[model samples]
Target chain A: MLTSATILSALLGGLLIGSAAGLLLLLSGRIAGVSGMAAAALRIADKGPPWSQAAAFTIGLPIGAAVVLAIVGRPEVTITSSVPLLVAGGLLVGFGTRLGNGCTSGHGVCGLARLSPRSLAATAAFMGAGIATVFVARHILGAG
Target chain B: MRHALPGLVVGTLFGAGLALSGMTNPARVLGFLDIGGRWDPTLAFVLAAALVPSALAYLLVRRMERPVMAEEFCIPQNRTVEARLLAGGALFGIGWGLVGLCPGPALAGLAFGVWQSWAFVAAMVAGMWLQRLYADLRDHRPVHFTG
Candidate 1:
């Protein structure tokens, strides 16, 4: 059920991310593409502000979520699967973001809007893989 | 204000829609994905609602001269379906299925301060780092996908 709190929170949350991405461009001349930022940070030439922006942007995510929880209370998180599986899943996602050249945000939102062919393929890949994994996890592994 | 500003505006509106539709709530998303343990079908409506805005945006953009940012209009190009592509897609899918979150909604969910989301984002960054390294080793130039 969609509550008023949920609606308000989402609106505010979206504003923050959009604002940050906008401010980055309006001020510094950069796209808030997470994969691009991560790539820049890992580069040997990376120094000063790029690293900071990447760190700050990455850090802001959790802080923002925390702020919401403080206001609306925590949601119950249940994981029936083992920790190893979860960690493995995380590692795979890391690799995928790299291979895909972007994650959901970079491709689904940023790339797609740009109408970048790469983003389209990447987004399709994102959805296709997600659907396949769900099918396998539910029917074969019985993980869900 | 011409380039990313509009994108930012569109993104914020999209984010708000997700939140209002209850798609941004991790628990609701988890329930939707669960399939067996109290399956929630509310996400269907969210998806349907989103189609309107998505279609409108596409129509608007199609009529525009190049986007306000770049030298030319952005268009996807890479079409070769290779091994790396398949592998990467599979991995991303597995993570999404397990966690019930993706980067966009995950970032939005960040407003809630979930430790798991932190972990997920951290892992996402690490993955990006590894990929950059691999790309650098494989090619002298940075991987620039035109498509």
Candidate 2:
């Protein structure tokens, strides 16, 4: 379903994210660190990300999609997995975020862009695990 | 104060775009990684989506004399190659290759209500926890980390 058109659509998507991060810095004196926001969302009471912030962040995701769909149309998806595996995966990521003190966005996008040491470490861990998982799944377990 | 709101708004828009573009969907991501099989080409799009804005941002920031938060532009200080760094990188690569989602895409995926994205995220957190334990045990030894 993807072609050069899809690539253009993606560039647009990345621009949206980079633009948001820039705007956030310009307006709020804050970095659009997903890990920090997410951690706050999970750990803090109402103190977590402002309801508006969370809502906006969540809503923006699909809105970005709407924009793409308007331009590039749609893409097909293929997956074969059990619900149990899915649930297990979500749980593991949540745990990793807590341990790492940030998610990829916090580190990879916002943090690394800012030249943060902590972010670099966090991103490295995130990618390392990702690669290892792929190797084990594909080569060892032979699972997709 | 108001400027900050733009980031939040932009973030939402970005996330939504990712979903609409199929970047947030693990299947699309996995397909891209499946070079050995069908070899879907969506990942290329995702990287492109990320690269352009980032490059522009770097350019813009360079033009600015100062950032909003600090007097000087942020720059990386650490330049080390150590064991812990290698270990962490390895872990991240494995996780990414297996699931086709990383931190940026994972958060975006969370909004789409994809079960697999959620799972990848959960496991990612666990890996961080294990790292922390090792760090504490090592008493903050020279742990290598990269961006």
Candidate 3:
């Protein structure tokens, strides 16, 4: 299932992602944490400085994705989870990202790059929990 | 106008990266998480690749007095390892494992024009709002720390 093209795509995509994060930091010194951006952009958080940047980034996420799809066409995507599970997942992610102060983009990438011990701890915590959840749900419970 | 332009461009690039890497697909994400089963190492590669530019940028930032556009580099200053951080991360991991959709991918999924993506995003937004409300009620200050 894995091909050289796929690996190349992953590498290219990853570099692009890193570039976006680096660009944002270089230009404005903001962490490209999607959850934080969404909270500020949606006006769910108290309005303050640079909220507009968050709004722009949030809007651009979908627009940028659409642009890529237009150029490259859609890839194989199968959402195995039901609607209820997605909702549950969404709620957990939303609350958790805020409570922890970052998501994959924040703690997993930028934080680690910056050599923040907090990011390391947070990333490890989430990865461990994620792996455990999958083990339990798929192996023990026999549920997908 | 100046404030928004960089964010928009960078965001577009970010989304394109996610799409190109196939990270937007929940199934692929699940494949990565399900190491107990048929594992896919693509995400590991993505992570390693992503760290390259990011690490260099951070290193570069150290030499520069300030960001090009911003007056100063704004980042989290707190280093205290709070229990809330671990608990919250764990909770987020559970959600991510369940659906293999984090905030970024879910938001980017909007471009897929899939109902599931929309649903996940809506719920995620609501969840964020709920957390904001909870924090507001708990303390007068807003939660903006990223440490």
Strongest candidate by lDDT = 3
Could you give candidate 3's per-residue lDDT for residues B90-139 as a string of tens digits? 98999999999988888888888889998888888878877887887789
- Give the Cα-based TM-score of candidate 1 against the true structure: 0.63
Best by TM-score: 3
lDDT string, candidate 3, A1-144, tens digits: 678998999999899889899999999988888888888887776633387799899888888888889999996667989989989999999999988888999898789888898888899888888889888989999997
Over B21-98, each residue of candidate 2 has an lDDT whose tens digit, in order, gives 566667776666565556677655554455455545655776777666444543434456455444544444444555
lDDT of each: 0.54, 0.55, 0.86
What DockQ, between 0 and 1, does each candidate earn?
Answer: 0.23, 0.29, 0.64
> Per-residue lDDT of A1-144 in model 2, one digit per residue for the tens?
656766776666666666666665544445465644544433321233454554455445545555555555554434454555554554455445544445555556666666666667766676556645655676678887
Give me the TM-scores for chain A across all models, comma-separated: 0.75, 0.80, 0.94
- List ranges where model 1 is wrong by over 4 Å: A1-29, A38-49, A72-81, B1-27, B30-87, B103-126, B136-147
- TM-score pick, better of 1 and 3: 3
By lDDT, the better pick of 1 and 2 is: 2
Ranking under TM-score, best-scoring first? 3, 2, 1
| Alpha-carbon TM-score of each model against the true structure | 0.63, 0.66, 0.95
Q: What is the lDDT of residue B9 in candidate 2?
A: 73
Which candidate, 1 or 3, would have the higher lDDT against the true structure?
3
